[model samples]
Target chain A: MFNEYLTHIPFYEELTQPQKDLLAQNLAEQKLSAGQIVSSDSTSCKGFVLVMEGQLSVSMISQDGREAELFTLTKKEMCIFSASCLFLPSTFHVQITALTDSRILVIPSPIIAKLRENNIHVELFAYKTMTARFANVMAATEEILFVPVEKRLAKYLAAAQSPIKITQEELARKLGTAREVISRLLSSLRREGIIKTQRGEIRVLDAKKLELKM
Target chain B: MFNEYLTHIPFYEELTQPQKDLLAQNLAEQKLSAGQIVSSDSTSCKGFVLVMEGQLSVSMISQDGREAELFTLTKKEMCIFSASCLFLPSTFHVQITALTDSRILVIPSPIIAKLRENNIHVELFAYKTMTARFANVMAATEEILFVPVEKRLAKYLAAAQSPIKITQEELARKLGTAREVISRLLSSLRREGIIKTQRGEIRVLDAKKLELKM
Candidate 1:
């Protein structure tokens, strides 16, 4: 019955029948509410989790309470933070929150261990997925260092949906800058007729003009 | 004969004799002079490499040619940039340079793939090493975003050998800022009798006072 859920997994088909049966039975399904914390640095992961639906944001908070988004996971994406304990004995320590109501599939660490022992491809899949996250993290480093906040803001607005539903503080955290900095830039854009700012949402007024900033 | 080189690797003991023999026979030893380019994004690495002696700096250059160090490798340290192609089909693209005369051991990608096929521990080592690098890069992100240049400057001075052999321009690049920023900070430090600067190096004169800045 649960085998249906495994169908969406990239590595699921590589498993032999016994391996598949073992994993199917051990896989756990979980549902999360929007804004609920999924995982963080403190709670060591017990299983490997894959996002089945909706969105998840992965971030790290500083000792003084500043937040920085590391990456995000969408439909059919695997959250390495949950499965990081498999590759590492210690916690990977990223804070994961359900950005929207989300559904997830989890496989117990023991089951993954058994599968990895029997199949090289299964192990390779883990390595591949881990490296994929590394790519995103590295790209974020490049963006944070090389790209200016103004250009990043323009890019963010350009990529986002109309009337983006995020508070100034949240947006600031995403771009790794002070809220005041983003507020100043957003105000500048508002004056230029590039974007409209409401209480917590932003509406793009000129997408073409925004591209110039990027 | 080359089997002696494998002894320093963290995962070598986990391999069976046949696995070790296969790796040893395939191992290639190479020497590099100071300032030699070990690898770069353009050169897709031919093999997994290990630094047997001397130092290697891993850095990424901006499109405008500003350089930033990602991490460094010394004795017994594995160069993941060389082996990244195995985990990823494309180049990982970090520039590697020999900081001094160095000795490196290389095992062709085919050998690593063959070993990974048979040994989960060997494959796990790759995953572990890759994740370890991820940790450093992420810490760098955190530092670059949150730590002030003054604090970073102080910390850099605190860690290095006396008479640090780096120009202000190079130091600015290392700290992810303009050369003038580092120059201004160094001048202030010089006035405080904390350090003395030469044409290309700065000698630490007051280590205790530098700690206060950090």
Candidate 2:
């Protein structure tokens, strides 16, 4: 019944037949619509969540209601926030929201904890995933501290294949800056002939120049 | 023979007698002098290292030679970098340097891996340590992005029980900013009678005002 989602996760594929059967029997799948909050700062993790489809934005909102994007989780990636529950009893400090229609496979916390206890491969996979996410978070912090906004914006643009169909306000939220800041930076890039900004789209005119900015 | 160091680590206390004996037989200790490089950006991790004494600084250097402090590892803390090696063959992107004369216990990668496979408690402890470290790194990142230098400085002062004994350059490095910037901010704080700056010390005069800055 759960063969599709189970097979989608690489770590699940590493499990033995019996272990796979156990997980398949215990795991539950939940579908979330776009803009739906999957979890909040105070929410206790239900289980280890594996993304089978679509994207989830992991962010933190400050006391004054400012939000900062930490990173995004897409298909085949496991949620580090849930894995963190196995270790400490502290509440999660970030909020996870579905950026698109998403399907998530959740193995109950107790089952995951038991599997981690009994399975060496499961334990190692969990450790590795947590470590990689930590590294990525550190890199994000470094980028915010050292890299200029123009360089960051250029890199973001270059990552997209063609014109990006994202609004300035959305871009601002992703970059952890104000909308006016993004608009001013985009205007500067447009003036320099580096990018052409439309009503709701931004087209990279000179990829080489944008790369140089990074 | 390894009782002293093993007893120092809380996780080691939970291991069975046979498991402890196994670790004692396989683990090796090494002493490093201050300023010595523990690991570099491209070095493959040898094993899970436990700091038995002193401190280690983990930082990343940019192409232009700017350095950003990530976090530090002190006594009884396991090296999360080595745990990361269990996943894929990827190089560590940060440098680890001995901040003081230090003693480290290394359980060879294979030995640690084998133990993790056989021992459920060992696996759980590893997961917990990795999770805690990830949380810390994220908090550090958040401080750098969301908090201003003055507020960060104020918080640092509030955390310390007494006067902070550090140089301006060291302070700048810790805050991930320029020495000149720290100097200017300190001067302003001194003028406002919030803190008194000596050649190598910052004595907070008005703790109440300092807390308000944060």
Candidate 3:
């Protein structure tokens, strides 16, 4: 299972066989059922979650009593919000919930923090992962505030085109808008034949029109 | 001068006197002139810049002649963007400019990285600072994208405060809007007695109305 997990990450391709073995020894595997709460906003964040098999949704409760879906995680992706658990007052900013029966490698934050010392490659990788995550969140926030709602929806469709299909409600939560508003906009887009949705999954029919909308 | 720098940072307040002195000795002071690019987009970003004596503007330029001012740094504030420089490709995401003749302490990033290994407090401080900065930038980006231009302008004013003294160009850059649009809005606000400006200084005559506008 650990070796299979290694296949999911890009870093493994570059590592020597011995290095991979070392990482495998450091890691432990755990299985989570669908709907499992990986981390809660009130709980201490101990370590990041690497999805070996399954999916997870990152969410937060807004002041309006709405559960906003920030993003989704699937195989090969690691969740770094657990790094927050290393600091005192380890309240998680977002909650991670398993969207499917999942197998994950829960590497303790202390061990990861230890690896950061004298391990330039791991440290750099962690830095890149965290920085990219923050940048994406910031960009999404900017898109929601400055750009038109239609454009924001279009961009979301462009970026999240795989795995756990996104619904209108999910899109609304991610965009920090109301479901009714997103439903209305989706209706308008449907009329214009810009996108098509089956079940909960949305498929973009016209990337060019979406770009134009942006 | 070193003590002056240490006193300004909230995280360093808990440090013993000798610890502060030791850290201070390693920092190198540099002076920059107005309009000078202190750190470019491609240059290796080394050392955290401790603004000791003047103001600086952090900005990113788009290919379309659009410039976005991330924020201005005063004596007590530190550059959050530089966190990337310490580990990643060592290049700055934004160009930092000395808006005024400024004296700054350039504490080498490598040294800080080394210190983190031995000092848990410093590591904690670094983590908090980076996380908070990322959160602020993400929030600001969300505000800019989802909120109306008027609300964004109001937010910028609320952030800078009255008498609002920043140039229309600066305000426009910060709000991601055209200078003409900002100028027109400011003119309307001036007409409504919401704000008053003399020379380069602005005073909010009625902050209450501005909140409503926001």
Model 1: residues with Cα > 4 Å off, grouped in runs: A11-22, A89-92, A110-123, A147-214, B9-22, B89-91, B110-123, B147-172, B177-214
- TM per candidate comes to 0.74, 0.70, 0.54
> Which lDDT tens digits does candidate 3 get at residues A74-150?
88898877565553232225668889999888767766676555454555455456555665654544444445567
lDDT (Cα, tens digit) per residue for candidate 2, span A12-129: 7677778777788898989999998887655546677789899998886565555677789998887856545564435336778889999998888788777777676677666666
DockQ of each: 0.27, 0.23, 0.11
List of clashing residue pairs for candidate 1: none
i-RMSD per candidate, Å: 4.2, 5.0, 7.5
DockQ of 3: 0.11
Candidate 3, superposed: residue stretches over 4 Å from native: A1-36, A65-71, A88-92, A107-129, A139-214, B1-29, B33-37, B42-47, B59-61, B65-72, B76-86, B89-92, B107-129, B139-214
True contacts kept of 3: 0.05
The lDDT, on a scale of 0 to 1, for candidate 2 is 0.74
Ranking by DockQ: 1, 2, 3
lDDT of each: 0.79, 0.74, 0.66
- TM-score for predicted model 2 compared with the true structure: 0.70
lDDT of model 1, residue A30: 87
TM-score of 3: 0.54
Q: Taking the tens digit of each residue's C-alpha lDDT, what string does model 1 give over B162-202? A: 98999987897677665656877999999999999999999
Rank all candidate structures by their lDDT, best first, as comma-separated numbers: 1, 2, 3
| Clashes per candidate (backbone, < 3 Å) | 0, 0, 15
